[model samples]
Target: MGRGRGRDYTGRTMPSPSSAIRPKRGKKGSETPIVTPVSARKRVAPSRQVVRGDRGVKVTRAVTIRRSADELYAFWRQIENLPRIVKHPLTIERVSDIASHWAASAPVGDRRVEWDAVIINDEPGKLIAWRSREGAEIPNAGTVRFAPAPGDEGTEVTVTLEYNPPAGKLGAWFAKLSGQEPAQQVTEALRRFKALMEAGEIPTTEGQPSGRPQNTKAKRS
Candidate 1:
């Protein structure tokens, strides 16, 4: 007898178990991994925002000066007085009839920043507006307006300044904390200018002695 023969011996064949192996059943303890359906996922739209650093900090300040508008405008035309009025270490040198060069110190270190600006608009005894030239240290523009006060109440000097801070909004906030903010600086400058133009000097407490000088000394006695 041969196994290959479908029929054996007397033309009759016995039934045999199936030649193909059946697949083993899964264990009772086995579990299928749960997959989240794509329809259940949340889709979020992207946000459109104006970056803080890209926008500038705008500061507007006004003060009343007893001097005439013409006189005030003439006084301001001399840019040399700017450094004295401003709290920051800065200087402005005239380049031409309508252009000037500005130099300022960095807030954190010994770096020097320079820029050139051309007067875009100027109305005698009324307004002056300027914008920084191309490739300046930082983008900046400003306008100052002089208006006559009512009832002979001197002149109203309005200043508007805008600049993109290096470190963005956070840096502007930090500068405000340190009293170097643009608003504070412009306000104080106006105050100083008022005092200087009216009183011929800026009042100070430098000569007055303080209650405690011990902290200032390197070594206490």
Candidate 2:
């Protein structure tokens, strides 16, 4: 037979030379045809990480505001004011002497999740801390500290946070990809806080009178 154009041994239409077929054998005796399907094979996702301990990723940030230590501390002391400066503003539902209930937008893999946290360490204007209490899509803990700048009239605010992301590599991957890097978020928040405090206005809520006493409690350096 005069070399028929792209004819196979069975005399059926054959694929072009550019499109060749290679057969692959599988672990089983059956041959797994290596034909390239019109559609690609679905990717296999990497396994997720399991939760081990209560410990989470820790991050810290510090910034100096133009306001005095007393002013900054006073503003921070009001748990209700958190939503004004926090990257993801949170609503304070219940406030008490030592504890508060909060709801805020939190981060998840490529998404924003809502969570509820309970205030833990409430040392007035000096320090405040909270942990995920309920409705926590991503478990986390946070602390804010206020101090006086050395030799300067300004106030220095440091914020520390730890988060236990959802049980998956996706969580870890997304955490790294988050726009609000924990440290950067704190720094930017402090900067915004400084601007807002200097302007005598809280970012979200109505401007309140600003003559509160300084918190003299001890704070970390």
Candidate 3:
């Protein structure tokens, strides 16, 4: 064999390999796989968004009412008018142009919960957003949006609320079981608001007899 050449098993002359470095290969019929170390690998980000509270619950409800956005906005802008649309009694005492004090009966008991809120964003006839002040009994934040409905029908109102339940997840579960969860409350409130705006009154079964009324008037001949 020459200095730069070698003879293969078939007795054919082949050039010698270069001096470049190369990865070592395993034996015939066996292969080695490259693996990234844990510290060097790129981690995938979490898919879900991180909400405000550690145990926060968000509820959203929307309704279309046969009323103009301006009219609906006017009614909702005044903090005192909220009681008219809320089934569970609410009292809102205005402290300023953008702040108010709120009190409402607790879902699970006769006791009342109170919170102070200040409007964070407000656009006439379009949007209103607020957040409870620090030390509030129920820390919460919410937004109400009013937009013109499709086909010029009326206004579309959407309400979104985020709050940390009093006792965390357990309290939320109890509230749901009692039909007083934020979702249920928001749904009912929106329904009542729609009724009031479209029909001028909210329908209720209060003070109604269980059975059908008798024919108090005389029957026709």
Predict model 2's lDDT versus the native: 0.52
Off by over 4 Å in 2: 1-55, 105-112, 168-177, 201-221
Model 1: colliding residue pairs = none
Give the per-residue lDDT of model 3 (tens digit) for 1-221.
34212322223332222210121235221123111111122331111121233455554456788999999998888978999877766799999999999987655545677889887677899877777877775667777888888898998887766665567654664465435545556667888888888888899877655544453233434
lDDT of 3: 0.62
lDDT of 2 by residue, 1-221 (tens): 43433333224443322222121235221133222111122221111111115334444456667667666767767767767776655577555654566654445444445556565555555666666654465666666777777887676676755565565754664356444244445555666787788876555554444444432233324
Give each model a TM-score: 0.66, 0.54, 0.66
Tens digit of lDDT per residue, candidate 1, span 1-221?
54422221223332211210111124221111011111122321110111123244544567889999998888777766688887767899999988999987665455677889777667798877676776765666677888988897999887766565556654554465435534556667888999999999988886555557654474456
Rank candidates by lDDT, best first.
Answer: 3, 1, 2
Model 1: lDDT equals 0.60
Candidate-wise lDDT, in order: 0.60, 0.52, 0.62
TM-score of candidate 2 relative to the true fold? 0.54
